[model samples]
Target: MTLLNVENLRVTFRTEAGPVEAVRGVSFNLGRERLGIVGESGSGKTITGRSVLRLIRPPGKILADRMEFDGIDLTRADEKTMRGLRGRRIAMIMQDPKYSLNPVMKVGAQLTEGLRQRDGMSAADARKKAIEALEAVQIRAPERVMEAYPHELSGGMGQRVMIAMMLIPGPDLLIADEPTSALDVTVQAEVLAILDGLVRDRGMGLIFISHDLRLVARFCDRVLVMYKGKIVEELAARDLMAAKHPYTQGLLNCLPRIGGSQGPLPSLDRDAAWAL
Candidate 1:
């Protein structure tokens, strides 16, 4: 089944200079599969993800020909319906754990709170589920970690906690934006493994957004290459090496390979049409 579908999606921000389009006519479909959106910082990758949950704030407008999730039109859904969908049906894990989590709250409380929001279970039930969720993310001594505040935990631990909180509700779709950017290479791999396992085991759809073409090629089933607020190419991950788009090829060539001599990196020569 197609879990989510976006078509002709456009997003713009109101500014003093003029209206700036962040996402321009982007569209894609997601099933119970791992899909990666790869692009540089201002490619509008993150904005598209945020628009999925209708998280775009004031002064930012989102217009789409069709933005449907499981046959429900997200652009037309009321606030009440969106409230029930967010965090429960379609959860998002933001870029940085530090800003995503509440600094004053204990990890356990935050995790349990997410569970409560979805199921309205008893406090004890929520706590038990919290522990189980933490354990599922491979956190040892889940009980001890639960009692610690976000600041007390390391960057990796905090990210795992964020994952646990988002997964506790068993969301059907997970949108992760630059999820492992702050972690060490080893930790990033571990985290990615955990996310991959969850998607495989639970049959949940995943949108893994990042700038790392190599990682996306290795992890996602399909890849969407975005540039200047537009999707320039979409191809199967296995065939990424054969990508015909100049932007995609440029990104792949930019990755430093092991034992490769360090010299001037090849820059992407952008055409005027690519900016649109």
Candidate 2:
């Protein structure tokens, strides 16, 4: 049932000075479960997620002792094979819908494009499937929404469209990179609920990358705390509040409480050795 296995995965970007290591010896196993990787901006969380799909751009190199998805070796996969798997089997819902979605394309066209590429279905069939996907994400009047452009939809609606498009191909694994970071609190909850429901109902593995520790604890099954390109702590989501690592504890204490009076949030004291 292990869907994805990454071992000793290292990613480096070629800079003018030299190679800048982004991810360092990161390894994890994902089954049909939700795994949250929580960290700050430069913690290499996003890079690790991108590396799984081999989405690293030029001058960026990904080296892994072993990187396999469902027994298929991703490190050795050709561009064509990776392309077929990228959106079809292992879809990624990026952080911002504004950049992720095509502004010129109608929502309907963009949503069904994945299905068209994967299944080669007729236009009518693709549209039907697109509508179904929109509805699946709890979008009301899916047909109307589909006809509209990305700019016409609200931020939340646009995100829903992105999710629908990603799920239209029925990917076995979903990598959600800061999915609700841009949404309001209420919209964040709604979108998380939709994602949670889909993952559970379809029994698909989810890798949610975020900087919100408390949200990850509440929404994910397992939590992996990353600091400076390494996983410093891994624990059950329920036990995240009781995490042992200093970094993890610092992150937990940083969450703002409604009733509690806080003077100043405790900043994480990073050790130089932790990066190694």
Estimate the overall C-alpha local distance difference test score of candidate 2.
0.91
Candidate 2, residues 1-276, lDDT tens digits: the string is 899999999999989999888898899999999999999999999999999999999789999999999889999999998988988899999988889899999998887776677689889999999898889888989989989998999989999899988898789999999999988999999999989997889999999999999899999999889988889999999999899998889878877789876788777787787776
lDDT of each: 0.93, 0.91
Q: After superposing candidate 1, which stretches have Cα over 4 Å from the reference?
A: none
Model 2: how far is 73 from its true place, Å? 0.8
TM-score of 2: 0.96
Off by over 4 Å in 2: none
State the lDDT of candidate 1 residue by residue for 1-276, as single tens digits.
899999999999999999999999999999999999999999999999999999999889999999999988999999999998998899999998999999999998898886576578899999998999999888999999989999999999999999988998789999999999888999999899999998999999999999999889999999999999999999999999999999899988877888987997788887888775
Model 2: per-residue Cα lDDT at residue 230: 89
